[model samples]
Target: MKLKLTLVLTIVSLSLFAQTKYSNEFMNIGVDAAALGMSNAVSSTTSDVNAGYWNPSGLINVEDNQLALMHSSYFANIANYDYAAFAMPIDDRSTIGISLIRFAVDDILDTTQLIDDQGNVNYDRISLFSTADYGFTFSYARKLPVQGLNYGINAKVIRRVIGDFANSWGFGFDAGIQFQTENNWKFGIMARDITTTFNSWSYDEESFARIQNAIEGQNQELPESSEITIPKLQIGVSKSYLFHYDYSFKTALDLNVRFEQNNDIISTSFASINPALGFEFGYVDMIFLRTGVGNFQNELQIDNSESLSFQPSFGVGFKYKGIHVDYAFTDIGDQSVALYSNVFSLKLDFSAFR
Candidate 1:
């Protein structure tokens, strides 16, 4: 039965990747700390508490109690993301977690204008508006000793709030499988964002009724309706090597190929390949330095310029007793200077039950 399920998941992932019109909404909200470290490639390893966001199957390797928090400052004055997660082992072979992620787009200038009776120039005042996106996740992982494998699933409730305009709600799921060979080879697979698109992005008529009445009273124009769709579908694989040396060194490489199906005019289905590599060196696992490269692609042809850019990232981590602290920096390149596309994240981990 497990084999059959895995095969089905593989087929569905491939099919989704081949589809066009990918949505880009909710893309920036899924960010996490470990992901910030390796350019968002924490899909396989069970080394940290952030695994709940990347590959839940990794939870099988977790012991005792775990708590983690991650925050990211994104491009623009738009929004910032904050993530928190907690995991605990139910047994030697089972683990469970709960996580929350919030994306907030701060004060934005509201451009709606109120004109005078004669259609003459009138004073305009900027009103502040903002958007908030949030998600709640419940995850579970269990190990199958017979196959030397571990599997997990995550169920989520997603919500979005855009000022006084409209709000949306949706549901989604993620699944993952991981295996280790007797020779110490590790392999993993994950399917993310599997669910239907949100269709509840509706506004309160009462909020706009006042404006509508004013415009109607003056025989002016009315506002048009607008909607947004959240993107879905991601599949990834990862592998790692553990080298036995005087000082232990571990290296890992992960690849994720994502596809979005556009459902609205603002989104277009596109394909992207993200590859990440990280190296960890330490003695007795006290301190470590990690660096990686990701998002390598061909020339990106924009309006008037052709640019080739890839995001590179670096991080450092420290472990004391059962507490861990990690910091990472990611570069967004200069293709669009105004975008200010750089990210920095910090994570704190604590093992309460261990």
Candidate 2:
């Protein structure tokens, strides 16, 4: 059963177009539980290390050296994920950040060599392999002279490995900006792959020949060596309100714009938009509760009817001094198509020790 599943995943991965619709998708999984709980609403209000992934411009709000870490499991524990990031104020007007992320399915059984060339069934030929993807990002943020305005840029590197059988190296750049109004309203914009990223793939011919017959007629030759990633944009707006002194409320909205028409809620010739909405309640800046809804899609029914569906996420956070802990119940895909996972993250402020 496991072997069959692995084969399916491998086939689907290799069958995509050179200029795919979803490229470097692992970056969209999000880093912080707090942000995921809000469906990545923090693009406008992010203030910590995780902002390196959400919107680098927000990193300018980091008051001190900060570090963050996160872990989660997916596909019924068949894959594991880890994320880490660090950010520091370079000066009064500039900040720098670095982040690393990894996702992998380990210990997959390789059955390509299960049968010998002499038509002999060899039970000991089965071996284990893994498929993994990694991303490293370096971010820089600068507060512009314009009041309440900040800008940021990111240089990203991507690495993917399939148990030594195949590998790829990719590079991309991202840019972002954030602005605040005197009245507390915030706005942000993030552009990913601003220059169009590309991945150069290479394969081991020896290993490649072993599974050339995974499908009846497919895999007859090597795949294209290059994969291009088009640009994507996210625009966000947010506001926070205080109740008396301790209780607080915040709401955020984001519009994700893809340069292609798809099953998004709003589609046009030039772009498709997916809107996300999030809400949070806070107490004394120490405890927080959050909820969000997003991932709108038009699903076709058996009767050829269209139905709208969305994913909802929930999370809680606790903070003491500068140490923060957050947990989120979220799904990478729509709830109907994938299992929900529990995610946890930690953030620590080095200045708190001083």
Candidate 3:
């Protein structure tokens, strides 16, 4: 019976993985420390509080209480987003963390119109519509002494709100492993979004009813209610090197490949390549600079025919005493300038772990 229960759970988990769709909105929200670390290609192994989002396995490095906060004013004002996380060690072998990420779109002009039963326009009102997506994550990490490896898992509660049509529930999980080697050589692997769809999303019944009544005369079939897929699969690796310098200069590089299937039920598949490099210079790890690029295929372009292009990014970070700050800017290319022109983010870190 125990074996049977395990098998059932495994099957359910895999089914959920296949059903969830991908959303670019989830990709654009940047984690704080990662934005400073060249978008976190090496994140699967790095020990930091933000690991709750990037790679929970890295949390094993936390030795004390930690707090992190981040905010991004995206696209010069289309929306505002923020992230916060806290972590602490439970014992020598384990660590725990909690994180929250939120994105808000404001002042959307509601163009919905109202009409009378006689088929005459009764009135038009300009109202505001807003959309938000958030997730709460719990993470745990442990270190294996024999293998010199760290492993971790993160469970998340996902929520989405769009004006009156809000989908308020779903769950997902991420797992990762990192190996620490001699001479500063590190290797890491991670699998993200391995769970069932967060299917709590549904239209406001009242809104659907209104639309149904409006179309009653046209004899149109009511639209089928359905849920959206959150983009679900990501696997990647990363590496870093320390420079032999008086100022403690370090260079790091990472490469990540992401895949998605059943994109909006139109494209069959899609892929992305992300490469980043960063340099740190200073005695106290106080100053840093980073740059990276990402490529997408034509099928993934905004208009569907434009050839896929590269997006370039740059960022900077600083550290003083017990506080850390970071920022990054990304250019999404001319074809997508109107919608994603440029994205920027800022993050702050504070921790009692020393």
Candidate 4:
């Protein structure tokens, strides 16, 4: 009987909702299909508008004004997730970006009316509503005086809504840096929620009263009654190679660290690390194929055994005259436990139109 302070369990199934474990879990669902296909291992190689979410420092690579759009559905199409972003160069050495992400489950049954005051079940009394979460990011990246080095930062706002029952707002900050060697090897580090995001929640007890009576004494609450996000860090290395001047490939690896001893593949009393590997192959820089394996976990079985599991993802992309279309099939979260998602994304280079 956990505190049902929110009807968030539905979307939260993806992350095993825990206040201190992974509070803003929705944002962790990678945005770009190309990146998601790579199991979110693009911290060092991301170079476009999508970088606004991946590693803003990478936005310094944007060569033109760009726009991106993406959409995905989870759990048999019960939840819808969408993302959009825009980025542009402010100067030869600086760039700015903005992005929005929305995750929602709509048409949820409102069972408060299922039984009337007469204690009789009514067949047509059910209605529907929705629960949604949104993330807004504003980013800035600038080349450091140090050659081949760049840095970026993000200001984020978060909004959560539970139909008309409750809502919350929060704010946080992130920073990152990317460095490239003359030999073309790349490295990056991103610090998320460096200041610890805190949420201010307000409940509509009157509205929620609808469900309160239906399940009285069932929902428990946290003893301390406050929500805050912990910080996370991602470090990566990547390199690209070309063969015959017509074929090319890039390989990347990222280590994600969170300050807690958890179920990650590599865990200790003080922290945990999850490693992701991504590879991309391109034919003449127009058609691309990508694959990745990550989200490793150890699950305890009913028979008292431990099983290792990992999620594998694949994606394809087509680029023509600065318009990019990408598709991906992947598992999000350890929800990879069984569910997989199909994602599509489109990117446009405004310079092409110019």
Q: Each prediction's TM-score against the native?
A: 0.74, 0.96, 0.75, 0.93
RMSD per model, one decimal: 10.8, 1.5, 10.0, 3.5
Q: Please report the TM-score between candidate 3 and the true structure.
A: 0.75
Q: How accurate is candidate 3 locally (lDDT)?
A: 0.59
Decide which is better by lDDT, 2 or 3.
2
Residues 1-354, model 2: lDDT tens digits: 776776677666555525456767887888889998998877888878888998999999998999999999998998999999999998999999999999998988787777776878686988888888999999999999999999999999999888867889999999999999999999999999999888898988888777686556778878778888889999999999999899999999999999998999999989999999999999999999999999999988999999998989999999999899999999878968768989999999998998
Name the 10 consecutive residues with the lowest summed lDDT in model 2: 11-20
lDDT of 4 by residue, 1-354 (tens): 222323335334312223555677898888999998888899999889998898999999999999999999998898999999999999999999999999998887666667899899785986677889999999999999999999999999999887776777989999999999998999999999999988776666676566556565633331222468999999999999999999999999999999998888999999899999999999998999999998888888899999888889999999999899999999865643668889999999998899
User: Roughly what TM-score does model 4 have, to 2 decimal places?
Assistant: 0.93
Please list the residue runs of candidate 2 whose C-alpha ends up more than 4 Å from where it truly belongs after superposition: 17-19, 213-216
Q: Which residue pairs come into collision in candidate 2?
A: none
In order, candidate lDDTs are 0.60, 0.89, 0.59, 0.86
The pairs that clash in candidate 3 are: 21-229, 21-230, 21-231, 22-231, 64-353, 167-201, 170-198
lDDT of 3 at 116: 54
Candidate with the greatest lDDT versus the true structure: 2
**Could you tell me how far off, in angstroms, the CA of residue 322 lies in candidate 1 after the best superposition?**
1.8
State the lDDT at 139 in candidate 1: 92
Model 1 residue 319 CA deviation in Å: 1.4
**What is the lDDT, from 0 to 100, of the residue 53 in candidate 4?**
93
Could you tell which candidate, 3 or 4, scores higher by TM-score?
4
Give the lDDT of residue 186 in candidate 4: 96
